[model samples]
Target: MAAVRKSTNWFAIGVTAAVLVVVLIVAGVVWFANSQATSPGTLPESSAVNTETGAIAVGSGDKTVDTYIDFMCPVCNQFEQAYGPTLDQLVASDEITLNIHPISILDRASQGTEYSTRSASAAYCVAVDDAANVPAFVKALYAQQPSENTAGLDDATLASVAASVGASDAATSCISDGTYTRFVTAMTQNTPVQPGSGGIATPTIAVNGTVLSNQTDLTGDPQKDIVDRLNG
Candidate 1:
């Protein structure tokens, strides 16, 4: 894209992004459903969300998938586009729950990481009023995911995008205030691999207790679709 021009110092984005995306997708196995504790039960490892109670496992199914995604990441956008329909079906059938843990790899990989964090956290503020809107808002952001280091979406545009989904101006205001920087930081630092999940990049998905490594996290096998039966 013109925005993510090659003229700049974007040479650094060479192989890291490609490698990161591939590993995350084809590496995970499955999340442990037997355990209720916060620890990683066994092999296949897990991508977890550190919660108040314990480590919350996530993914997509009749149960739940603890999803860790970055807003400004292209792969994340692709995942949403491919799998979001399945998510809607699951929500309708009340068969699956997505505990999405949005992080900020945009800064690490793209320039929009910080802005994406703001946009995401702002959506969180909006979700406080209506939780269903977060997915829709996230979908929009991903649809607009540009190359790394592109900027222009200020607080107003972000808020507008949020409002289009359901978030209010007040929620947008809260996002602009930059309250969730810590959450974003914590997300980036998460490894999300066998050892951990902090160091990993965006769109890291964990089903039940199993971290999926079969296909691309962005465009997986669409388990949500199987349950929904919205096929052609």
Candidate 2:
């Protein structure tokens, strides 16, 4: 009887161990699934007419011009102030498709406010809420860009800027709530591996999928240079 009891006890112990292992495995799978479900996928209500690869795009021309910029970069601000009008004109005339990629390379420069991310996320909000006004909203944001090391614009200021560009209350709410912050974070992380755009820096310009290495003169007329490049 003692021998039989010992054998039965061993079997019970083995069964209990097996059940515990299965429970652990099931718990791990559930946690992984939940994490994946919470991860950000793509921008909400993204439209191809004004967005591609997480960029705010305008125009439907044959030639493509991709502009990567960080709002906190002074040099990027200069580039925008110099070439913004020209780019807008080209897009308006359908001479070239203009795709503006708002990235968050300078998040650290905002003194812990993560201004670059906030601004980029706000831009995404504008894109989702008011796609047609994206260009205007971008120009306005650059116009009021704060210097690095500052706290950057607060949420109210950002919302006001959006309102100035005819963005509705929905856009303001979206910006305030940071609805697309996770999406912006994901886009920034994937910038290097972006299809047809490998390892880019701020103010990076690409014409027809060809990235430019040399900096074009900010003072010189970019219209002619852009036209030549497109024609070339």
Candidate 3:
């Protein structure tokens, strides 16, 4: 009877130890998941703004052209490639002030890598660290935009792209750390509704608060159709 009692006590101790181990494992997993869901803290000064409805102003002109883009959106990339040169010329000539709003709406398309947010965050890093190179950086990013459902460009690749576009070393750290990821997340979540457009969409172009009904109106001709539309 004494031997049986001792055996039962040992069994109980082993079971208790296993239960504690399982509880610790569950707690650790919960903590990790929570951390992943939370933002990384405040954004850098250069890229800081009200992520809900703010934009990065480029060029100062009487006319304001607001462009909303997402790095992972194929249509946004196409729009950039088509109208990018014309827009740049307009900004350079002071004909229009380009308000480039880099938002993240296609994070789901990046195979869980959150490429849209990562790329947008990297752009913000460039906007703050190398303000003059924002256009170049943006062009570079879209030029090499990855296809959906892929891992997308890694941090090192993004940093390298920034460097190619004249972004300083500081931009590299900002990109690697994903400093503006939360900002991008916020912007994506809180996109404002535009008149006539219903909900916000990538590559949405608005001229002086009037969202353009037709994207193909520009026709890639800065001196002709684009200028006509802008002037009109």
Candidate 4:
């Protein structure tokens, strides 16, 4: 009877150890999945794309102007509406090189559709297929920007938006497949931390590699502020 009791106890301990091992395996799998979800899966390949800086280069000016934007961010759309013309003028005049970084930090606002990531990825698709149409596509995206917590534009609508901007058939295919979503995630993670914020924010503008401050740099007139910064 004593031997049987000891054997039962050992069996119980083995079963508990087996359960723990299974639990540990599950935990590891969950961790891996989360990591991969956020990982920069692949870098975009294009003459207009700067993988090192994670920006879609538009102009070949001397001074660099980088705008980190999330498509789902309302503030970003507002920024575009306010300064899109100024930036376009600057680019056209070759005053500043516009590096548009299509990032995804507002995925939480997209009701699980991950609109921010999808749109940004679609931008990359356009960049890949037709780099020149990128600016138009960006403007069109903000023109039809969806409200927060909504599912946002479906894949087909995104494709149509691209097509409206003259993006090619391959660009539409890329948008539908979400080829650069992981790339957008990686860029969002690496988004430059602005001064005083201590966190990532959309429409974060950097002039000549210096992050601008809303208080000191942008004093009510963003257009003048950016122009002055470029000329400064």
Candidate 5:
């Protein structure tokens, strides 16, 4: 009985060791893949654009507010509808600097269209060409937000959207050529993981550099919550 028990213990130890090794190998591969991801070269330059963080800056004020949004995220559209006016008012009053980070993590949901990346890249194109019109372009994109798992608006329609917002001249070519797709990917990868969350999520809001919780902090009333956060 003692001999059998000793053999069983050794077998269990060996199996556990093998599992640990496999887990370590998987972790290492994931880390390596992330490390080797594509790099964004020559960031878009504009007075209203943050070249370092890939955020489109709106309004210059004492306080800073950041929003990391995925174009294909429906919740982001809801966020925009709810808080867009409030943010605009704050910007107009010069109370807070709004940093809009256009990111793309839902490209897979776009049915091979890569709409998330394309739209984000188009926004960057607008930032490079007509910085002042970027906000309008964003609003337009959200207004025409496509359903998930559907092929999102095509390149021509994206350019048309830019034109509708008076960003046609250079933006059209930029969108058509997908000038900042890689940059969008890098920005998406760099999106800050919200507090209490393990991964990046759309419509991540940060006030004065503190990420807010959408479930607890933003559940009751987002507009009021954002204003209170800014004021507080």
Candidate 6:
């Protein structure tokens, strides 16, 4: 009888423990869901303002286009991957002047690490120090945005990436020092972005500060918008 009672007690204890665990797990899920909805702490998108240095020129054909992009954004990466080569061609041909602005509005984490923003800041620093190869540096970073929480980018990686794009140490150091924080900040907070005509998500291409592809003004493929203006 004693042994049987002991076994029964053990079973009851195990059941109680399991119930408590299930309760805790359910509560945790609720809390995490709430947190995710609130602020998952992702960095905000980059801003699209440039009252200071002015917007980038469109392809060299007397047309100027300003493009606002966030470094941490997957779509932004897709844009770079897809349209970067085409834009490079246009830039090489002097068909358009390009102003690429880094907007920072999507980098936040529970650990207070503004991942995307930091990368952007680094890239901005690169640009501030060396105005010529900003595009190349941006291409490099976007090309290798590691999965979140794996490992953050360090200065050495940035330097190597910069060097790969022909940026010298002096220029790379500027990226490390983050000298363009204010410039990048303004691009996010105070910068006034011209709306693309259609409401398509960003990686927006604007010609001479006018957004021709926003939902409102989308006449056609953004490239066509500028091409028409260029041909005219």
Indicate which candidate wins on TM-score. Answer: 4
Q: For candidate 5, give the lDDT.
A: 0.88
Which runs in model 1 stand beyond 4 Å of their true positions?
1-62, 109-113, 187-191, 194-199, 214-220, 223-232
Query: On a 0 to 100 scale, what is the lDDT of residue 111 in model 1?
Result: 51
lDDT scores in order:
0.58, 0.78, 0.79, 0.88, 0.88, 0.61
Residue 60's lDDT in candidate 5: 88
How many residue-pair clashes does candidate 4 contain?
Answer: 0
- For candidate 1, the 10 contiguous residues with the lowest summed lDDT are 36-45
Q: Determine the C-alpha RMSD for candidate 2 after optimal superposition of all C-alphas.
A: 4.3
Candidate 6 lDDT, 1-232, residue by residue in tens: 5555433588888999999999999999999987655431322222322445424333345666566776666767866766677677777888777887676665552134565556666665555445566777887888787654444566678678878887777756665665555555555653345453323345666655565544455443446655565555
RMSD of 6: 12.9
- If both were scored by lDDT, which would come out higher, candidate 3 or candidate 5? 5
* Ranking of models by lDDT: 4, 5, 3, 2, 6, 1
TM-score per prediction, in order, is: 0.63, 0.80, 0.74, 0.83, 0.82, 0.62
Q: Write the per-residue lDDT of candidate 3 for residues 179-209, one digit (tens) a residue.
A: 8888777666555555566777787777776
Quote the positional error of residue 196 for candidate 4 in Å. Answer: 0.6
**Distance (Å) between predicted and true CA of 60, model 4?**
0.5
Model 5 TM-score, all chains together: 0.82
Give one digit per residue, the lDDT tens place, for model 4 in 1-232: 5565433588889999999999999999999999998778777899999876679999889998899998889988888878888889989998888999999888898889999999999999999988899999999999999999999999999999999999999988888888999888778776788789888788788998999865466564655778887787
Judge candidate 2 against the unseen true structure and give its global Cα lDDT, from 0 to 1: 0.78
- Colliding pairs, model 2: none
- TM-score winner between candidates 2 and 5: 5
